[model samples]
Target: MNKIDLTITDAFKNKVINPVYLPYLNNETRTQIYFGGSSSGKSYFLAQRAVLDVISGGHNYLIVRKVARTLSKSVFNEITKAIGFLKLTPYFTINKSDLVITCVNGYQILFAGLDDVEKIKSITPAKNVVTDIWIEEATETDYDDIKQLNKRLRGKSLVKKRLILSFNPVYQTHWIYVEYFAGKWEESKNCYSNDDLSILKTTYRDNKFLMPDDIRELENETDPYYKAVYSDGKWGVLGHVIFKNWRTEDLSEKAKPFSMFQNGLDFGYAADPAAPTHNHFDRKNMTLYILDARYCYEMTNDLLAAEIKNMIDRQVITCDCAEPKSIKELRQHGVTAIAAKKGKDSVNFGIQWLQKLQIVIHYTLKEAINEFTVYKWREDKDGNVLPEPIDKNNHIIDSIRYALENEMAIIDRPKRDRPMPKRGAL
Candidate 1:
């Protein structure tokens, strides 16, 4: 086999990298974190990206976990799987006992654990200095472990010396979150980046190839806290959650037989995103079905009009009243748009209205799922839960509130007295 084929193998990579991770293909951040729920493909994607990085340029890449025994079944297996997926097995030497892969060109991929400090210290690549490091299950290691490992990538070269961390966020108090994500509430989005740091948040929804049974199993999770942390891939909040009457479902098929369809819009730009949603209400069953929701940035009225038409042409879309000019422009562009009649205390009233019925969100709406998971009542400086919710991380939800405003007058179906679900107290 010609080694040159490996150099021009975008085709192989196409089969390896998932669509959700395509945005970071050329990432040069000093610190890149691939974190979310379990089975989110974060670890696998990291291994796959590292495999491609090794071929594009020559370097010593170290992949580590907390213990030596765990590396074989986890990151090590993922690396070998990535090699097989990209059909690059012929160009590299895999030393199973040493847990190393060496390219024909003398670049190396090394595996170690913090437990084997001397082994990690003795490691040196044949051709290049340590150019990259991936700390798998990073939550297992402390701040000092990363501080020492960060020093390993000493000499610079043609490529960016990246320090990659992959883990399922297990605790809000974890060092990683406090260090990099304490004040940034918007970090729950699909992607967040600054100059030298990048963060990607994903859930099972982002993995399109997941089997139906696998999805069913995950969505069937009953423990609210477990579902939030593992299934939805958001940092679970234990108390004072606003909406527990809602759950995610495979709604594309479930909502097909419904007769009524309406839409909603919440306008945003720059720091905030334009949120739009398609919904259906069942008066008798007291169910509000969120069929679709989107979080988009830098969208203009023309683009928003186009997006509305694409979702459901000619449907009555209730939009924020403050954007009357936007509504007028949308009307000019042929969108059946109107303003929502939000009166005094409309935000609180909307929350009260929604809390009365069961909400079933479409399983694929990842951003919306995250909003539902994290949206909580605001608190005063002394930590009293305010009547209104925190304003951010709630664009999709605001659209839902606007979309279903007209139905609030409908006589609510007799709700069974059931205990509201709460995240387990940590």
Candidate 2:
């Protein structure tokens, strides 16, 4: 095989580079995911592969970021720095306006962002025909948009096109890692092949290139939680949760509105338990406050119904939806119970809607608040993170999702045009 002469920089050589990177450079794998703590040399290795692909004459590659701003700051600079460091500029034309680098031998490297739908759509891989696509900070981009880009890469060549994703594992349940990497292995009950995909995990300890001072600073950080999350890549709960941030200590008696109260139920029977969340929508403040939560394990329909009745009798809940049977029984007991819309997509819609809002929940709903703190994006073997499945274990969170979905239509009402009263004193 004819090979182009490439020089390894002293910095690159000194770094604790993973062996997985070498296979990517040799085009032995069509897909590669590199993940680890910061300073793991994943970015540096990706730059090397991009340079190699650009110089080899037959392939075109793309370096993708979440947004154009990030593309300019991170991915673009990384590639250019690699080119300069390796003294490969003589063989490539760097086009800043179009974000394309054309090699003397006809290969091209394109820099692009995935945030804007139109920007992503404008690039026809059929025309340029990318051999490989590199997604930097893949966690930040939308999973749907990434899939759209994958569909566009119908390269002219017979061999399958490749995708390279590199990021730190921020969310345990992110879709990229879950569906593509971990999900597949779990389903097959065996290790996946290179033909399937490969995830190379690296950590800060693996990066031998960091200065002693830099390493010392990471070690000497005062906040143990920050150090664990940032430097060690260990997952832990920290900071005020999404809903907890909105809590108020004062729940003193105030004029209660005659507004209709509703409860959203996310059913989990056995180990996970069913969670019913009461939401009080104060139209006055346009805020939906989680008034209470009832989480019970392995309860019969009769037992669940009794619990719902008790909450209603105590004036803690006026209306609720529990199990399907419980909802029917509550209706029989003169309490209005409505069955929640059941579907994965519907649940997702609710979750997404709540995420977009400046939501506040009462301080008493600690379990509901805790769920949001730990909820994270699922990851794939290639280190791509996507949203996880909505399941019974996340009953309270799912109930919140359902409530938000149903309430959004009413919450999103447009301002009404008022008739002009006669200009009184004109």
Candidate 3:
């Protein structure tokens, strides 16, 4: 076998990829998991390592995400970047139409997604065998998909085989954690042989290439939950908490209410609480200002209705759809409340949508602030996060999600028409 020259190897040795990953460059572990947070350079290192494997000859590699449409922008680009970094562009021919890169040495790298099963089945490698696979965002895929992918690693191969998995620890109960970290695959009828598994955890701190502002942004993360997961590279317990993207701000004086607004209400009796939320959306900027809230336990539906009238009168209120009786009762008492449109996957969809927006909870909504810190998803006996969340600590989140999902329809009214504070007020 021809060896890469010392000069060409320097391109890889010098800060091209983080040194934290250098030790595992030639790792033979059958299953290698690189789990971490944003800007950890995990994907970048994997790209460089995989390209090196191709250059070493006698190998075919498949890089995948959950959806095929995202391949061109993510893994494909990463591999091309690696080629440029290693100055190997002249030695490799990129077939953008097929999303494949072929090396002069008969090695090929294919990029695809699991979503398109037919396309994945049709992939043929021009090597000894398809010996290496990288599953980016492995959490998005389930065990069934992985088992099928594993079957492709058959046939004679000179190079060691590897099924590399990389993803953030977003959901603790995801199959990757269940099979790899917790080691509870017995009942699931699947297990990894002890000798073949290697797990590497990393975080933004591991990558020294981050800029000063990037480090500052990560250091200044105020959400305790996100700090533990993204910054420290720890697994967040599923069904534990949901809103790690928010923070408390004094909106009592800073944000004055505008005409474009909505409210949500959740009714409860006895030990349970009835919570209501007043929310305003800055549509142009995609910011949600949670202005105020009403939270009280052992309050009658009538009393809650009266409070809603005084606090968020005449505004369109979308309450928990499950409680049509309460919605009717609130309307009877002159509170403009309607049932939220609950359809299939509403909870997860609403949660995912809220995950994307910039949410600012006013300091005055103390109850909401408290709930945001503890709101969690529901988990099965195996600790897998269920699609639905636990009923507790979610009245505020429920109210807020309902308000946002329902109010988002009015976003087309034109942002300029919505009353904004005087230029200097904020």
| Most accurate candidate by TM-score | 3
Residues 1-426 of candidate 2: C-alpha lDDT, one tens digit per residue:
224566665466334344545544555466677766677677987887678666754567777876564566577778888888766778777777778777776667887776466766666432247777888878655567578767766747533578778876554445566656654433212124566576666656766667888788777754433555557754333422223334443332431553456566665666576676766666666666666676655666566666666655423332224456666765666544566654434544555456555555555454555466454443334433344432322667776665554566576423212221222210
lDDT of 3 by residue, 1-426 (tens): 333432446555666778788888888889888877778889989999888888877668988877676688788999999999877887789998889998878788998888689988878787667889899978667688889898888878888888999887754544566677884333222123458887777788889889999988888864545666677666664334667778779886766647788788777764467788888878777788888875555556787888788887788888898888878878888988888876655666667667667889986554676567667655445445555556666887878878876554454313323332232221
Candidate 1: clashing residue pairs, number: 0
Score each candidate by Cα lDDT: 0.78, 0.59, 0.75
Better by TM-score, candidate 2 or 1: 1
Q: What is the TM-score of each candidate against the true structure?
A: 0.55, 0.53, 0.57
Worst 10 residues of 2 by lDDT: 417-426
CA RMSD for every model? 18.6, 19.9, 17.8
* Model 1: residue 373 alpha-carbon error in angstroms: 20
Q: List the residue pairs that clash in candidate 1.
A: none
Error of 3 at 406 (Å): 11
Alpha-carbon deviation at 32 in model 2, angstroms: 2.1
Count of clashing residue pairs in every prediction: 0, 17, 1
Highest lDDT: give the candidate number: 1
Prediction 3 TM-score vs. true: 0.57
